[model samples]
Target: MISLRKLAPALCLGVALQGTTAMAEEVLFYHDKGFWSEALAKVGDASEAATGVKIAESPYSSAEQYKAFVQSSIASGKAPEMFSWWGGQSLNDLVATGKIAPLDDVWKTAIDSGDFPASTADLFSVDGKPYGLPMHIGKWAVLFNKDIFAEVGVEAPATWADLEMVAEKLKAAGHTPFAATVQDGWRGFIWFQELLLRTNPDAYAKIHTGELAYDSDEIREVFQLWSELFAKGWFTDVRSNREIEDFAAGGAGMYLIGDWAIGLLESNNLPIVKMGAFVMPNVDASIPPAVIVEGSPIVFSTEAGQDEAYIKAAEYWMSADGANVWGAASGNSIGNVNAEAPNEILSSLDASINEMGASAVLRWWELVPAQLQGELVAEFNSFMLDPTMEQAEAVMANIQALNAEYWADQ
Candidate 1:
């Protein structure tokens, strides 16, 4: 089992105190994005205006510190009124703590009014009870530079073969075919997940549940293809921290990332007209089309659920008006189906996804078991740096070992 005690003291001196006293007069909205303070403040203002309850925004500098503080607070029976959390296994682990309250009632209200799709409930639910609402929903796609593609005489690829052809063309034109890095450590899984989903999405879905082995032939094939790409010099230097900036400046041809990166491109002064996006084509055409979806959820504490004012504010946060306010302020795709898309790229991508009938799979980061996430990510990062057949074998071995141990105990 995951221990909450270890995280309690890590950030106690910095953030724990802030969550305590705010519960008296306001609903404390604690989250890890310090940069999102202004955006969240706007949502808080709107919530207050609608519900007559003040929503206080508390932003933490780093995810580690924020998680530590939230875990510690929940352990001490003093959990914050509201906080943002990742879905999938992370949310499942939190729900197991019994501190998070089921928001089935709130979700019902949203669904009844067509504010949120009923399917969204599955993302934040554990054992059939919903515990949170979506904060942001992003689709992972191939974000490419239109000018670079036009210059190279290549358009968006519609198949795995076409993608390779595009990469070769871009490389011959003196451009890196793709942006890739292990800079933050967690990013090693970006391509790993994408390739696996494109090649064998069924295996990708089952592997996280321990029903499929990490060292199986299907996974080995993914590594083989990845190694071939590395050998061809199709990726950016794994050590570089400027993946997005390089792609923005035309140093790279394509970047496979979530639609959320649109905001980063805009911030870097990359014109929206120059950006294009497409869902990755399947390596196995026999399989159904699929796109990865990442959903960040805002969970409420059981203690906070007792406060009528806070509950009212949370209800407002789930409404279309509240979603519009938050989406406009944050430049994010709101969970509410009725809310406007944050940008033209996202709007078009959503339409394409619907038109193609692509299956929406959860991103691997959240789908993987919480206990094995960091260790497995480290293995993948090492593999990205080496990317040899020899290293591929060792990486799969280490991942399977960690995965096996976690599932054995479960």
Candidate 2:
């Protein structure tokens, strides 16, 4: 059996829960809070006006916390009809519980209209059964500071070699080359994982499914490259220590983050002139390929208390108009397949991403199985902090061994 978790990967985006009044039929929602909740509320307001269902949301922090709440709720025979979340092993795991309602018709309508790429629908499917709607088409890039490059008398990095050159120059000037936050365990994974995408994509994917070992030659090359880069003093080493300027603080030279980083940038009143983004350079000799996370942020309506009205509201929240408002508020590109997102940032970012065309790469975290996620992340994290040749080999071998064990019965 082809493990659904390993087939297609991507993550997040959602809708509001319904309220109690006729215009406020609340939905029980567990979300990552902040923008997701606030943006979803706005989407719900428009949706309510258009569809007479008010979406109400109960917020939470982080996927792990939300999922734990969900597990306990289910154990107690309770689950929210629609909730917000990423789609990877995360969604597939939930689908396996037989609690999630498949939105086959909803997705088919979307696919038939060409509103969503087949990959979007594939993210939430398990065993050929559909489970969620397409809500975001991830727009990703490596965000950097224009001023920093100018200060160092360097141009914006145009390729992989450019990255190495820029890193060396920035280091010589004694400016932190990269700004990263490890307080959030997920953030570090972004660095190693993104590089792995350009370094060893196929083996990386296979590793996620327990097919290839983490210690494989391809995997070793990935870490060797990363370790060599770090040993060159390119990284800020803020993973163990707090960064001089975190992603939110805005003074760091560069950050490899989602397009949503633009929103955080703007909200801080930092001028866009202060920053820009570029694609990661390909290490492969087959020219260069752009990569990004392609799945939408979806609100999984698991039926909290009263999900009927809430689900309908969640459906409406995904409309073009609703998505546009979300895009504007996000100060980032709307991940929605049919998003009429109005923000200039989103438009500009979207235009840039489109130019990459078929070369854009989606992230591995979203495509790999749920069970294999933690293992891969941990191994990568080790390499990121104190990367070693031995650790690199062990990481790949451990991954391969784990993958073999994980899929042995499946």
Candidate 3:
């Protein structure tokens, strides 16, 4: 096991705080990129201070790498004592391995103490047993450049017609109505997921989990809408950076992304006032609006030697202080109701959720089974790269085939 001291001096406090034994028994925490410096580090320091247990954090540079590392480690019977993961299907899959420890005791304490709400707790559970604690929450929306919108003389869209009108206006003004990329297959997922939710969020959930067919009329409607958007030339270069140059340079009028991008946008020197975000409009007026919410979780391993230390670390990470630190650093809304949002962007997200009463659907990245997710992304990429009625139908058929094969085993 790697020690925290070897990583950095700031993280080395674990040794001096409780001596060699506690440092040796340190809680090894692994997470994906975006949390290494400001977010998770702060939580690590706070956890060590509160529990006298050193936390050695190892952050992988990408989600793919992190997932691979954890899976391989677990297979080798050497997974970290605690590690970050996505909720929903991702957490359930980890639970199936029988290596993850249930945090029902810690969850009960957090709920009673008001550190977390029941809704957030339920998100990280499988079959009523809690498996992890949320590290941060993200609400997905359309982030537009205020300058570009002003130039086009259009406001944020609130309905499907309004969205179409705004798109036409932007295009007429010689700007891409939307910015997206298919070079990386996952980029296509943002559009597909939003369209699904806009069509029927309940059906979206059911289809992803295999309770409904992916090629059904409901899902076909989603693709038809997406195809229409493509036919109208609503999207920009699929290869450009979605959050940075593409939207920031006014090449694309709008960018659909999660709240986590707010920090990235702000860091790019775009003034907060110039960036505006809104919930994606529903496809039909009769359907209520809903937003996809994604939360990262930290799950614990049930390995014999590290249960107590893992529990302490999980407690600290799930507490109000940890959420506050994480929120302030990541600029993403947190699941802990008691924790305050760090910036205006996050504040707006929280307000929108409450105002719209949006039903939380797990984002596409984490909600789908890993292999099925890859297949879905591949199909979406194929359709976007050369969108046509023929391509859309083929993609739908492919999805049905993939879903049938994948779900049959489960």
Candidate 4:
């Protein structure tokens, strides 16, 4: 939990506190100081204005911090009434702890009303009972600089072969081929996920869900391809720079990142009008680009003895109207099947994304046993320091072994 001493004065003891001195009824809604949280606060505030419901706010950065706070609070019986969560094993673990409440009733209504996509809703279900709300059904799209691509004489790559050709052409023109910030370890995952998606999408999903071995030949191949890209100087070496700001500021040809990068691009005044998005270039065009559907799910709890208002708030969040409001506020695509996107660009993209999504698949990150994603990221970081042929294989093998033991213990 956030150290009480570190809490803002208003939360520590002042009137902003939603729960009483007895701390009986409160919903601790958390967000990191990012676009999503800020956007949530913006639209959620409007929701409150209309509905007169107040949710207590707590913020933290990094999933580790969020997990630490949640875990600590469970012991004190001061657990949050509801907070952002994800599906797969992550939600299963929480439910097993007996703190979380089932969302079957709300979800049944949502499904019947067509508020969310079934694909996304299924992620939050445990044994056919929904435990969380599906927020964003997003497909990873590579946002690139159109002006930069045009200047470099590179069209959006249609396939992995085409992408390699573009990267080489950019290098010949004396430009960095890709914008990557390997200094921050988690950032390395953009490349890893992209490569994994390209090489074998189903295998990628399986490994994450503990159904397949992480160190298998398929996983090894993905890592090897990543190391090969480094060997070809596809992106900057890790030692030279730690921040993507330089990469963005540099006249790099492309940045293989998710849609959220739009916020960063617009914030930097990078031209999105000239910027365009496409599925990450597949290593083999014969294969469809694997899209990752990543966003946080909101999980409620019975531990806090929250007032009926909290449950109503959770239901309100999953409403179709809430979807449009959330999408408008964040400038990000949402998962609601019935919620019409407010922006033309996002709507168009969403249409194409869903069309391809029917044939392609999403790699479930939240399903990966807890700590596996973190540990794999760490190993990838170590490789960034000095990517060797063995480094790639070693990384996957270690993760596979560790996870095998991890799941057995469960």
The segments of candidate 3 whose C-alpha lies over 4 angstroms from its true place after superposition are 1-27, 34-38, 46-56, 209-211, 304-308
- The lDDT of model 4 is 0.66
Per-residue alpha-carbon lDDT of candidate 4 for residues 42-105, written as tens digits (9 for 90 to 100): 6566556545554456677676676778878776675667677666667777777777778777
TM-score of every candidate relative to the true structure = 0.88, 0.81, 0.86, 0.83
Candidate 1 C-alpha RMSD relative to the actual structure: 6.3
Best by TM-score: 1
Model 3 per-residue lDDT tens digits across residues 1-410: 32233435544676677566333345667787553455667667777777876566777776667778998989997767778887777788888988888888998999999877787778788999888877667788888888989988999887889998999999999988888887434667889888888878778779777899877889888888888888889988665545465566567888888878777667567767888888998887778767888887778777622466666777777777777776666665567778776688667766777898876677988878876766688888888887787898999899899889989998
Best-performing candidate as measured by lDDT? 1
Q: What is candidate 3's TM-score against the reference?
A: 0.86
The sequence of per-residue lDDT tens digits that candidate 1 reaches over residues 306-352 is 66866787787888788788777766776788877777888888888
Model 4 residue 21 CA deviation in Å: 22
Cα lDDT of model 2 by residue, 1-410, tens digit: 11001111221111223333222344444566554566667765666677766555567766567667877866776555666556667677777776677777666666676666666666667787777655455566777777778889887665788887888888888776777656445565677677677776776567666667666677667778877877776666556444423643544577777776676666666566576777677776464566677554454534421345655655565556666666666554434567665445556556665775636555666666676676667766776665778777767676667777778878
Off by over 4 Å in 4: 1-27, 33-35, 75-77, 117-119, 209-213, 237-251, 303-306, 342-345, 354-360, 407-410
Give me the runs in candidate 1 sitting further than 4 Å from their true place. Answer: 1-26, 49-54
What clash pairs does model 3 have? Answer: 181-238
Full candidate order by lDDT, most accurate first: 1, 3, 4, 2
State the displacement of the C-alpha of residue 385, model 3, in Å, after optimal TM-score superposition.
Answer: 2.1
lDDT of 4 at 96: 79
Give me the overall lDDT of model 2: 0.63
